[model samples]
Target: MAASGHTGFKRIVKAAGYSWHGLCSTFRHESAFRQELAVSAVLVPLALWLGDDAASRALMIGSVFLVLIVELLNSAVEAAIDRFGGERHQLSARAKDMGSAAVLVSILNAAVIWLLLLI
Candidate 1:
């Protein structure tokens, strides 16, 4: 057998489980994460309902997930920024703001995707 740490599909499953745990930890600790998760729950099912065709379904579902993914990344960045210091700094603030901007862009993307699909 190969010496890779991940033996096979089991490794993928284990990694995914680990990832889920991490996401859960963020959800519990981060208010923004919790909010995003709540939004995703509603949006995902609604997207499924709105998706009358294959392309629409994929677009809606994919866009919702993209927002969630971006939120997670933004939360991670904010955490890292907080860890760097409690003191105020221009660079740190900019970093957090940029991460926030990224998330906002992703949300807009999701909105556009849904709107276009529905049309």
Candidate 2:
């Protein structure tokens, strides 16, 4: 298992801080993340307004959030790949392309979900 230095409240606080740092880093460094966040900002409120029921609302909102989550993970993958391998290699290129593909798929998924919900 991983290390947990603090207990309960302190741990929660530390985690929140870490999360904030991650968000800031992603927003600052990742254009795709920023784009997804902008989409989420628009969709979340629209979901609350458009969804006929709680389940549908959750699905709508969750789909948008899922895109952001996937983008973050994809960004992390790209960052790790870049950090580990500076030289040009097929595997490194493939890894970055795969990460980009994941982000595109997530955006498509969110779009489909929204369309299905609205129509």
Candidate 3:
């Protein structure tokens, strides 16, 4: 397999470190991420308490996490767009708009999931 660069526990640790770094960077640079994180902090615990069963809990929790994931992706897209420069361009605007739309959809998904699970 040509070593695959990293192996076993080392690969897991490295992946974890990268994931932590990404989370920190996203939290530091993105206000939207921070807001979502704050909301997740509250909702995740509530989801566990409010859910009637394991599957309901997972659905509620997963939906909230999905928002965080989408927000991170959107932040990444916006960062890449900014990296290209400050100049205005149609493509860059479109990319940013699309990333924003993805976040909105994820938020809506979370809302629907919570509502369905609760009622």
For 2-30, candidate 3 gives per-residue lDDT tens digits of 26688888888988999999999999999
What is the total number of backbone clashes in candidate 2? 0
Q: Best TM-score goes to which candidate? A: 3
Ranking by TM-score: 3, 2, 1
Q: What local lDDT does model 2 show for residue 83?
A: 88
Which residue pairs in candidate 1 have backbone atoms (N, alpha carbon, C) closer than 3 angstroms, thus clashing? Answer: none
Predicted candidate 1 versus true structure: per-residue lDDT over 66-108, tens digit per residue:
8888888888888888987799999999988998999899989
> How many clashing pairs per prediction, in order?
0, 0, 0
- Cα lDDT, all candidates: 0.86, 0.88, 0.95
- Per-candidate alpha-carbon RMSD to the true structure: 2.4, 1.8, 1.6
What stretches of model 2 exceed 4 Å from their correct place? 1-4
Instruction: Please report, as a residue range, the 10-residue window in candidate 2 with the lowest summed lDDT.
Output: 1-10
Candidate 3 residue runs with Cα over 4 Å from true position: 1-4
Enumerate residue pairs that collide in model 3.
none
- Among these predictions, the greatest lDDT belongs to 3
